[model samples]
Target: MDKSAMSDPQQPATVAILAYPEATASVVYGMYDLFMATGRDWGIVTSGEAGPSLLRPLVVAARAGPLLATNEVRIEAQASLQECSSADFVCVPDLNIPPGESLEGRFAEEVEWLRRCYAAGATLASACSGTLLLAEAGLLDGQEATVHWAYCDELRRRYPKVMVRAQRALVVSGEGQRLVMAGGGTSWLDLALFLIARSVGVDAAMQVARINLIDWHAIGQQPFARLARTRQVEDAIIAGCQTWIAEHYCEHSPVAAMVRLSGLAERSFKRRFQLATGMSPLDYVHRVRLEEAKQMLESGDDPIEAIANAVGYEDAGFFSRLFRRSVNLTPAQYRRRFGSMRRALNAGV
Candidate 1:
């Protein structure tokens, strides 16, 4: 397709969503439902006006048969890979699996299909673990992309050429913005709105958001991420340091103490710590402190200074700055947004 044909304002663009085994049903069908409701549903319901549909969304399966989602929910493919000649946009949603699990030979044909579509001028987009497929297809080589936070390490390990931006909500790469990636599982919504705005119009995307009541712009995965998620390690030295840090994170200069506990030279301890946990000793201590501080902020009425002192930071101002950088929200803002005895009580906590 020519550039002019792609930019044509008359006809609705074709949006093909890929479905495969072990995919999350919510993401697959939710995308179809959201895009399908775009221009037509909003216009008719809002003012009884029939607006031109902005997109032709279809679920494409590799085989010409039923596809089962992770929970055994079955969906028949509306179009097979052989049937889809071309598309303006292609979406790959998350496949429900552990982050470290290899997807090497799981969907070879789908990877090739994605490559063929991209070569034929389709803009490719992926959400959550679906970025794995893009990397497997060699589409993301040497390009900045985002993946779900838990999978960032695995993605980097598996494909050393891809630049993984774990913090970003949506990343657009390639010349002419032909490649896009959305971070986290729910970021598919962000990707959808972004594509709609870029292809259709900002007004159309906003209209869809309003109709669906989605907080499209205000969400990113950073704030919701838990910094204390465990990593299994075989190194006994690093394991002991991890346990020590968790128990003594409130002490001053915990990294020095952890290094001493490791019974190795400081440099060797730092190297081994990073190898085992994918973070520096100092970073691990900071994460431990931040995790505790977050719990205190959510459950208690302590002042910021008190929380800082409890977390081993003497300077509350410095702690606040670090907290903002790490969590993307200030201490006060975090408490106000997440803290609330009333809300906790309502949830039966």
Candidate 2:
């Protein structure tokens, strides 16, 4: 339970990005840009709701002194590290705190401030190596957390009392209290946007997404699929081909054309394609067509032949057979089942 991850309910969700005497500029700028880009008070000004909040953010340095910046960017700090009041969320952001120098002496000051803030009802959060700050603070002594996978082993080794889990994007603990953490450098944006969404609303979160050009689905979502690491290059090729196929399904692009895009020789491409996706290129194309046919069947009233041809299938029976084989149901049956599910989900909501 990294103390930084635990958010306080009473705080207007102020994130005071901690500026260590030797913190990196990238982390500092990243935190600053991410927050300002994503956060804005709508000033609904309703009598019932709290009037437009003045709770913005401040980047402060430890020890109430000037701090060295990374990459020669000397940003001024307006608040002292000891100025821990007026914040519901305090972020160490990202910095490398040496293991031997942490959890004691000078590091004690930051930890004490963190504990005080948490006790005062502020959520404390860290990003990447910033988790080390919390571990040093002893808040993670018996709690599960996630750091960048490269640092997970070292964090666990240095603080044996902290239970480290590496499989997820973000780790959360503390019910009334909160301890949430993330792996990967860019995941900091995810954590920040998530905090914004929780404190504000989805509109603010989406603004963050547009600012960072981030994928909307992954923000605030946990247990991110590790599949990206396993087959990133291959997946990119496949996704490119998939997009091409979807756009050109009606054009009836040849399998050889798709195989060429994979950059592998025909025979080798077929083998790898089947190994990667469990289906040959043409079979996958056919599957896509059949899937589209199923979709058409639900919202559309076109004839089966027209739908089949629209998805690159000319023979009606062949399309039906392929659709049934891949989807475990006939096109009509799939339309019924999935359409029912979609309608039910929408209606229930």
Candidate 3:
């Protein structure tokens, strides 16, 4: 089928991005911008002085008033938490995980909310550590969930029942649009584009990717995707090595160490690791640290120095600068924007 044959894919998707004080503006704004462009490109809605208004991307709050992002970006929510009930697609983007009760905090409310939303046929999505909230809500209790890699341990420990696949680009489960996970914040662009493709058609989705300068492709199977090699000797070794690293990322090791632990030769371990996991062992570790820093910035108030050290960085200043360059926000600023939630409630006096 040609791209010209289908249009109006946007009709079925109603994306309601939840604005938790810590939710990144990049994720929110990026999704809205790309989705709109996609709608226009696919002829789901033509662009002109008089264009169709088929796709509506909105930022909604769990309560009221303006919300802040990690970079101090502010945006107003058009609907309240009550509004998720009406949305066809519901998102709980990067909600700040308060240290102790990030998941358990307001767990009952969100769980009930998800139960209702899912029952009503709304698809769900989360970026960064937002999956913790979904896990709290029970949507991911027994399903596969992918989040920023740093929190993989916590997710695995907290919800032992759920199969937490850490260090992945994303995870898609539940038929049609039941559940979706986008790992890195930047990956949100990819997820949104895929959503657009479904709603408005591929041509429009591709156009948006072109406009956003995003890379959209089915490159060799996902680097993080699980290989179907079965439980072979090398595969077992790789799994043990992964378990070892998760426990001790701060300690440095050469390929020989991983090889010895896996009981495989360095050459064989390197080859199978690449095939099973799609990345060299060290590349995977760096990916984990980066993901951890992202989650810390969005949910906690620890200084960059503390966060850096806690996440395996000994040089606080270097980590601070490197993190900002990578995430597009200083660690401190990212925390202020995405973690702290300020509510203007009960002031009708």
- Top-lDDT structure, candidate number: 1
- Clash pairs detected, candidate 3: 9-199, 9-200, 10-199, 22-338, 69-337, 70-337, 70-338
Residue-level lDDT tens digits of model 2 in 181-296 = 76667787777777777667778777567746775323222222121212225567776776677677766556878777778788887777776665677876765665567668
Q: What is the C-alpha RMSD of each candidate to the true structure, in Å?
A: 2.5, 12.8, 14.4
Tens digits of lDDT, candidate 1, 1-349: 2344456778678888999887887888888876777788777878998677778788889876787878899977788998886889999999678877788888898999999989988999998889999999999999999888778888898999999877787899986789999887788888898888887788888888888887763545666677634644689888888877778898977888988888999999889888888888888888889888988988889999999999999999999999999888899988887887546776995
Better model by lDDT, 2 or 3? 2
Local distance difference test, each candidate: 0.84, 0.66, 0.65
Off by over 4 Å in 3: 1-12, 41-53, 96-101, 175-177, 217-349
Model 3, 183-262: lDDT tens digits are 65467766786666655678767767765679742321123222212223446778787777666666655355677888
Taking all chains together, each candidate's TM-score versus the true structure is: 0.92, 0.53, 0.57
| Candidate numbers, best TM-score first, in rank order | 1, 3, 2
The candidate with the higher TM-score, 2 or 3, is 3
